[model samples]
Target: MKNIVAVNDKKQLASFIDFPHDLYKNDSNYVPELFIAQQDMLTPGKHPFHEHSTLQLFLAYEGDQIVGRIAAIQNNNHNKINKTTEGHFGFFDCINDQETAQLLVDAAAKWLKERNMTSMIGPVNFSTNDICALLIEGFDGPPVAMMPYNAPYYQQLLENTGLAKKVDLRAYKFIAGDYNDRSLKLTEAIRERLKRNNIIIRKINMNDFWNEVVKVREVYNGAWDHNTGFVPATDKEFHYLAKDLKMIVDPDFIYVAEQNGKMVGISLSIPDINQALIKIKRGRLLPFGIFKLLWYKRKIKGLRIMALGVLDGYRKMGIEACLYGLTIKTFQEKKYDYAEASWTLEHNTMVNSAIEQINGKLYRKYRIFEKSI
Candidate 1:
């Protein structure tokens, strides 16, 4: 008999976190998430998300064997901003059996319904700001840093349990020699025109990281406020994320546009550290894992253009092109093998057009699912 149980103790939580490791053990494309990071994200007091929201984890088992896992989340901040009492389900993993999948989804739905949430939406580990979505396309290769992956049957599993497509997110890939340098060639002219308007594009200063992050937060919150499901990060949340990102962020790939010393836009691309993380067994970073992380980091050949946005008044001023151009320039200089600009909403035509203009191929697609609880 299959049974679902709440994860209440450290042992259950460890099992919850490690379930995917065993499920994907023979899959070459699977990359285990860092254990400490997963622990902090799930633990109530450890992650800033818990300060304004709550999540309950569940594990599905058949006798002594683990079969599935899920997290039911009620994000107060998301509801407050979006004006919807919609709960979320994330960190989902399971065997290919439809029965086990139904049990896992039912457990999460029951938890959300108890909290008076009328609808369920996700694959979002927390919110749109974090790793969110199911791999609906491009499963032939390993996922990039911060992207989620799962078995091919996951789509059917959720659909069978009544979840439907809420939205599709796209990931565009730019191979080193495949893309044209038109954006790079126009960089100087774009900057010259922007200079006339007193707007200057420059690299982020690692020495003044705290101040730079503050400016980035402003642009980040403002630029994405109108997006489909965006929620502005609180001060603590942004700082917490900034602190973690600072360790692996490359200065060359981070850029900001300033007008009269006030930040108006920002773009940040991070090294694809999955290249290094894939070698760390079970995502442990102690003894030998840390050494592999530090040693393999320099050999990484790709980046993820994680964020690029301009505030309301700064649109159409060539700031977007400048940021993209500078990023491509740096990618060329470093001789990286490839880069992926990802998770763009399917309806975001302007941004999608810009990426396509630079020859970014629509390589992968992911989806978020929702259901009425």
Candidate 2:
């Protein structure tokens, strides 16, 4: 008989995290997320997301065999910020069976309904701040670092379960020679023009990393406030995420725009560590996995231009173009094969135009699904 059980212990949690590894074992493009990282994110005390919110993981079983897993998330901050009582379903994985998918979705919907949530939206792991969405296109290759991936059958499973598209997020790819470098030539002129207004653009200061993080966090929270489903990152949450990114962050690829003494904009890009992570079997990082990670880290050939945001007052001052130019210049200097600027809202025409002007090809699309509870 098919049954759904809430994960209540370490063993079940491990099973929840590991189910996708088994489900995607035959898929060459699948890259397993690190088990330790997944554990920390799911655990209440380990991730700051749980401090102000709640999530319940559910596992599907047929007799003794595990068939699927999903997390029912109540993002208190999201509802409070957006003034909508919406819950999320994330970490979803299942077999090709529609029955299994329906059961899993039902469990999550029931949980949210019990909490008085009026509607549901996701594949959002917690929020747009984290990995979310279902990959609706571009299945031929693995995802870049910090992006989500899944089998194409997921689209049918979800839509059949009553989820409908809410919005689409896009990822743009830039091959080394294919991208226009006009921004590089225009960056200095733009920088000089901004200097007349006492605004300057410079690389992130590694010497005073924490202080810089605080400034960048302010810009981050302020810059993306108008985005759909955006909830400002808490101080703890920002620090927690920044701490992890610090391990792989490159100063050359991170820049900030400042007016006199205050930061007004920020752009960050990280080397595509998924290239290294794909070789780490089952996402375990010990017993030869560590050696593989260290060996492969040096050979990564791509970057994920994960974030580029400018405060409202600072927009159209060429800060965006300058940041992109600086990053693309560095990417060329290092001889990286490609880079991806990702997860842009499909309706965000201004940002989309900026990316397109530089030859960023919309190579992938991910969708957020919504259903009324």
Candidate 3:
């Protein structure tokens, strides 16, 4: 007999969080999210996402053993702003059985339908603001911070269950030494051109972070407004993220392009914190977890180019090249091995080529799925 239970207690929720560790035990690419972080995110009153949104976690069991888990999320802000009745299913994991996978997806779909949701999409854990896609390619290595990963078979399970490809997300890697130099030279000229236009690229003001963040928020919201499925990060989401990134943000790699002192473009690369989170033991951050995190901060090798965007009028003025140049400069000057400019929309050829111009290798790929209910 099979039973699907909604996680309501601490023990069950812990089991739900730990299920992936068991499912991917033999998989080298599988990285465990910090147990404490997952707990806080899933726990009400802990993560601000829960303040406006709702999520229900379900675990499938055959007798006393666990087979699968899923999170059915209703992002009220998403629907209210976009005026679309779409719900999301995230943290989906299941054994290699059709019945088990179906049960999990059905529970999610049914729950949203009950709430009057007309359509469904995602493996979006919280929102696109968080990691929302499934790894469909480049499964050979572990993912960096804020990226999602899953078994290849999971793709088959999702499609067989009626989910369809919404879009493909890409991650590009750059080996600092072996990288191409064409863009490196071009970046200099690009800076020269931008300088002639009163546009200058410089590091973020860490001392005035609060004031800087407001300016950044303005550019972040305006620059990517045209991208598909992009939702402005709520103040809560931004702060929650900033708090985590504070430990790893290097001002040199966090740059903004300004023209006459007005913000025009922004780029930020964070030390791949996943290196430390992988050791956090199921996302727990108590006892020795915080210690491990602090210890590994300086030793982090890779960087994730988390955000880089230029507004409409400023495109093609070398803002992108300057951003990449600064990152590469930091990598070489600091002697870091490689960096990843990731989770870009597959269709975003401009930015992809911008990174590629600097000899960035297209390493990993992630995908988002959507289906009509």
Q: What's every prediction's RMSD, in angstroms?
A: 0.7, 0.7, 1.7
Tens-digit per-residue lDDT, 258-365, candidate 3: 999899999989888878777766556778888988887768888888999998899877798788777787778888877888878999888787777677888888
Candidate 1 global lDDT:
0.94
Clashes of 3: 9
User: In candidate 1, what are the lDDT values of residues 1-373, reduced to their tens digit?
Assistant: 9999999999999999999999999999999999999998888888899999999999999999999999999999999999999999999999999999999999999999999999999999999999999999999988999999998899999999999999999999999988978989999999999999999999999999998888899999999999877999998899989988998889989999999999999999999999999999999999799999999998999999999999998999899999999999999999999999997999999999999999999989999999999
Q: Arrange candidates by lDDT, highest first: which order? A: 1, 2, 3
lDDT of each: 0.94, 0.94, 0.86
**lDDT-better candidate, 2 vs 3:** 2
Q: What would the TM-scores of all predictions be?
A: 0.99, 0.99, 0.95
lDDT (tens digit, per residue) of candidate 2 on 35-86: 9999999998999999999999999999999999999999999999899999
Record all residue pairs in model 3 with backbone atoms less than 3 Å apart, i.e. clashing: 33-283, 34-282, 34-283, 34-284, 35-282, 35-283, 35-284, 36-283, 36-284
Candidate 3 whole-model C-alpha lDDT, 0 to 1: 0.86
Cα displacement (angstroms), candidate 2, residue 331, comes to: 0.9
Query: How big is the positional error of residue 178 in model 3, measured in Å on the Cα after superposition?
Result: 1.8
TM accuracy, model 3: 0.95
List candidate 3 stretches off by more than 4 Å: none
